[model samples]
Target: MSRHQRLLALLVPAILLWPPLREAAEASMFRHMLVVFPALLAAGWFVAGALNARAQAAFARWNGMGLPGLLYVTVVLTIWMIPNALDLATVNWDVDVAKTASLFSAGMVLALSLRQASPVLQTFFVGNWVTMTIFVGVLFQALPTRLCNAYLVGDQVRTGIGMIVLAAAVGSVWAYGIWRRWRASAVVDDGTGVQSS
Candidate 1:
């Protein structure tokens, strides 16, 4: 990537962390669960690429990241997915700060690990993410009461709906990518009495 692109990646996340954007993101359940979280990670991905190049190189050299790295990513994502955890991150300044740092780090971890992961493992990560997206979407939409103290019942429901929409979009893209890969690899016979790929 060009330095400019890397700079844009790093800056966008940091810019989002500004109080106005941050507050807006956490203004509702939907924003918090979807927008802010993704923005934070986007920043990390950018920053890690620009800043963690050394660390990633070292880690990559050290036998390549295996299951443990994936496990760490799973744990980080799962913790942030909980409604109560989201509330804590928003309401508590200390936690919010920690979350900012950790979430960014989580993004870094994903970037680093993704580069080294097996195709099957990459599929597993995407599968887990889609499952979580659907689960949270369903829970938010179906629950009669508010699960988050920071947001209202309506906000929760809207967030759920948004999550479901996002899940669909992400799932479609992932499936398309998989289909493309498969088609590229599959052997096909052409007409003319000769085998051709």
Candidate 2:
């Protein structure tokens, strides 16, 4: 890995683990879910860049077209997105540690496996994630009471809004990327057998 990636890989988890920063992130349900969890995943993504060829090969043998890795990510993210999980993570150090570790590992797996997946598989996984995210966001907003014991109803509503926006943004970006790739590959042929870009 490059110096910057290595530094970030180490720095992000350290910062998240630090009492003050950790406390700050956990202070709000919005920040804990949107900020802290993503950061842990990103740290793991950075760690993936450091993997040796042999290690990557080994991971590939088990991950197969990225299906397993994406499934793991989906499951981990799904579990953590629950309000109960949020409450437990905020109050229980053990659960919080497990959350961090699982998210980080999920990130590494995503980074390693995504490039190996076909575009169709990528779409299936990403679309499923987006759909579920929006579903959770809607549920969060629709519920009048607080689902998480550690957070207020207002916090839950705001988190729901954030989740919706995040899902839309990610979906848009992925769709745009696919559109661009499609445009790049499109070809036109004239009746004379001439091709134009």
Best by lDDT: 2
- lDDT per residue for candidate 2 within 35-113, as digits (tens), equals 9888888888888988889999998998889999999989999999988888898888888888888999898888998
- Per TM-score, the best of the predicted structures is 2
What are the clashing pairs of model 2? none
- List lDDT for all candidates, in order: 0.77, 0.88
Query: Candidate 2 — which residues are off by over 4 angstroms?
Result: 1-4, 188-197
Q: Please write out the lDDT profile of model 1 over residues 1-197, one tens digit for every residue.
A: 86567667666556656788778877887777787777878777776677556766787775264456666778888888798888988887677777777777778778778768877887898788889888988999899988888899998888888988887898889889888877765635334566565
Provide the RMSD of all predictions against the true structure, rounded to 1 decimal.
3.4, 2.5
What is the RMSD, in Å, between candidate 1 and the native fold over all Cα?
3.4
The TM-scores, one per candidate, come to 0.84, 0.91
Candidate 1 lDDT (Cα, whole model)? 0.77
